[model samples]
Target: MDANQQVPSEAALLGLLQQFTLETERYVEAISNRHHLHRTDLNALAAMVAAAREGKTMTPGALRAALNLSSPATTALVDRLDRAGHLERRRSEKDRRQVHLEMTDSARATGSELFSPLAGAIAPVIDALSPEELHIVMTFMQGVIEATMTARKDAALAEPMRPLPGT
Candidate 1:
């Protein structure tokens, strides 16, 4: 870099990455508030809907792992969403004990209405990128996600440890 154009420091880049996630979370919070849902509940519903859109089945156990919640808490979460008419639970055909979660029609509509605007806004920004640029962005995001997970694990190792929220 020229004297007038300094390379970005790792700390500065990390801050930027963190701020992006943080701000996105604040946006999620706002959407959740509008829907009278907890942020975690909103996230759970969103994940279920997204998975369903991709023709994937989301088991309650898988959701527990995904959300890092305890079994009882996951059950409670499933119950809450079910009661709210945002989600439904179904027993596995092969294994009755295996519970699967899916978003209800109301959830599908509300989640889409709440989240589609942000998707629409970002579409152009993503569309501006070439295929190679998109790949690079995906690779970078995967690396960042892995690094964040590792950091969380390391932090947990350093602590006495508590259960995940809603657990």
Candidate 2:
């Protein structure tokens, strides 16, 4: 093996990882669309529902940060979900200016019903994994997530496009 040569193991692993991600995304998108929700809205709804389930509330600012959206965009998303009766925003009692988001009862039920089977479907595969294999898979997944996050941050920081000064 030459010092300059890359490891075949790494290349094979990366290819499988990429394929898994692409297929998973397509599957989620199909599920979301079938349920009459955009992928982003479904993601937001799931986040709000999970937070509520944990007895925690999320503010618009937090939601915006999590979803990587501007305040206005967050507000619009909240407005749409609220209008659809999927979520509700209430002014914080301590700080009336701050708005907290929560999923409606119907939304909670719907989300649970939709996700339960999906969880069940993956349970068998999870059960089949040995503890050590599960740990390795999770560690590799975390590395991939970190790498993707870093790439996104780096892209965000790239120099802005500008027309030639002479033109």
Candidate 3:
């Protein structure tokens, strides 16, 4: 910031973060609707893709835990994606009993189709950032994510929701 500029207030910063989250959620919902995928399915695919980018294998159990889903629900999700040609189940060569999931070409194409426009829109802003600015932004994002995860864990341990009087 320049000498004449004031730092953003915490409320203003949080508001901006909220707006960014809302817009991102809207974008993801639009993609899910257009692709005829449930949000969970899209989330599952995203988890798998992130794992692949990290050079880690995604197994059914791992996915279930990542998504906090029941085994049967995860199995059903895998089957649905498999039938849609979006993913493949491969037996681990080192352990035939273990199964790993791989995103198929179709899934990659769909993901590109879904996100390319958003990436194009955001690329210029990201490109304009200096390395130092980029590092700060990355660190800020990581901090935000960690805080969000901590909040989620806290919420999970809070009192469970109960039905309203009428419902």
Candidate 4:
């Protein structure tokens, strides 16, 4: 513990963080229900929207890897999204065989409408933090998220594949 931090305080912080995660998951499930999307589809759309925000191209292969879907499944997803006017495919100039995916304007607008309210609601709380505190929070959150992602990856590699219950 730091000189200023007590053991009980640390434990309380951990408990609060865990609680926050559970609440956030519930919120995401609500959003998924509102849109009538399967959670996996929502996850894929989230990843695609994030890529769009960063001006990154998500190729079919990359999407497959990201979603852990088969080639045919990925193609089906791309086609479904295209039909919904949510995503579009582009061919590489250098290689006609290469296809990259990008979100349509409608998709971006819909995603923004759905997700921006949380950001708006949290702005005041985030703004209340001192600059240094905000920086530390951001840095710590990034590390924690990355650590969890790595742990999940490790578990996937080490464990036998299992289907969902009642599947």
Candidate 5:
């Protein structure tokens, strides 16, 4: 290719893939918001519900790690969610020092109802893909997502300080 000519490569393909993924997420959020939940709150509640469903419990420390948040940030998130009646912290039966995070009944029901249609719409598409194709696509998508996440972390760390509007 000449200097001005472009050659399509894996990077170009991944860019298109990422765009589609983000668009799908935006669409899902728009649809879910019709049911009265903001996308971020829904995501947090869903995460807590999934962990409970999978027989895993999250402590404040685990949540901090999972969200890549500091202890104070995680505590604030937990407090807000708790006050919203979406989740509760309980003393762990097996470990006294650890508090297990659990989704409240209302949150679980709301999440399930909000997501059921979205899940139904995607199920057929997923089912149509062959097992091998699904695995390959999932693996590639995971890799792309991980790379994007790491890049975001690095960018945040390297961000320049901004001056106040009038200062």
Candidate 6:
């Protein structure tokens, strides 16, 4: 993007994105291991925490869908996290049948302690971005997220590939 640099091709840009995703996954896996938590557990916690920040409640059903988990699997996950004191299940006052998911104080503290270093490293890069650049990056990232969701859904509906015989 610099004056002396050529604009990257779409393939090059996609390669960069893929690299970024892999690196992020590595970081998440490392943190999850250190905290004695499964990667899926961390993902569920992250979803709930983001929902809380947006003033939206996360329900068990919603969490299941967000994580693409089966009902039984979700129930097991909830039970495990609850037992670990990292998650709370609150019955909705308006609907006794509805159960909302929330992160416990311990979970929040663990998340903060684990991710603060990454945030500190990235904050300066974000801070240096101009408003226009930030907006563009946000829009681009959102579009990529939506595209990934669509691709996932499509892949889910497709027939599974089988290995060729007589290799």
Best candidate according to TM-score: 3
lDDT of 6 by residue, 1-167 (tens): 67999777999999999999999999998988998999989889998988988999999898999899999999999999999999889999999899988899999898899899899999999999999999999999999999998999999999988878975
Q: Name the best candidate (by lDDT).
A: 3
Q: What's each prediction's TM-score?
A: 0.79, 0.78, 0.89, 0.82, 0.67, 0.88
lDDT of 5: 0.79
- In angstroms, how far off is 147's CA in candidate 6? 1.3
Query: In candidate 2, what are the lDDT values of residues 110-145, reduced to their tens digit?
Result: 777777877898899999999999999899889989
Task: Give candidate 3's whole-model lDDT.
Answer: 0.96
Model 1 lDDT per residue over 42-85, tens place:
87986786677789899988788878899999889888989999
lDDT of each: 0.86, 0.84, 0.96, 0.84, 0.79, 0.92
| Ranking of all predicted structures according to TM-score, beginning with the best and ending with the worst | 3, 6, 4, 1, 2, 5
Higher-TM-score candidate among 3 and 6? 3
Q: Distance from true position, residue 45, model 4, in Å?
A: 2.4
Per candidate, the number of residue pairs that clash is 0, 0, 0, 0, 0, 0
Which ten residues in a row are the worst by lDDT in model 3?
4-13
Task: List CA RMSD, all candidates.
Answer: 4.6, 5.2, 2.5, 4.0, 5.1, 2.3
The 10-residue segment of model 5 with minimum total lDDT is: 35-44
**Model 4 C-alpha lDDT per residue in residues 1-167, reported as the tens digit of each score:** 68997668768977988999998788778886897656666667888867767887889898889899999998888887888788888899889999988888987787787778878989999999999999999999998889889998998889687888998
What TM-score does candidate 4 reach? Answer: 0.82
Residue 106's lDDT within candidate 5 is 75
Residue 166 of model 1, lDDT score? 96
Which candidate, 2 or 6, would have the higher TM-score against the true structure? 6
Q: List where candidate 4 sits over 4 angstroms from the true fold.
A: 1-11, 53-55, 161-167
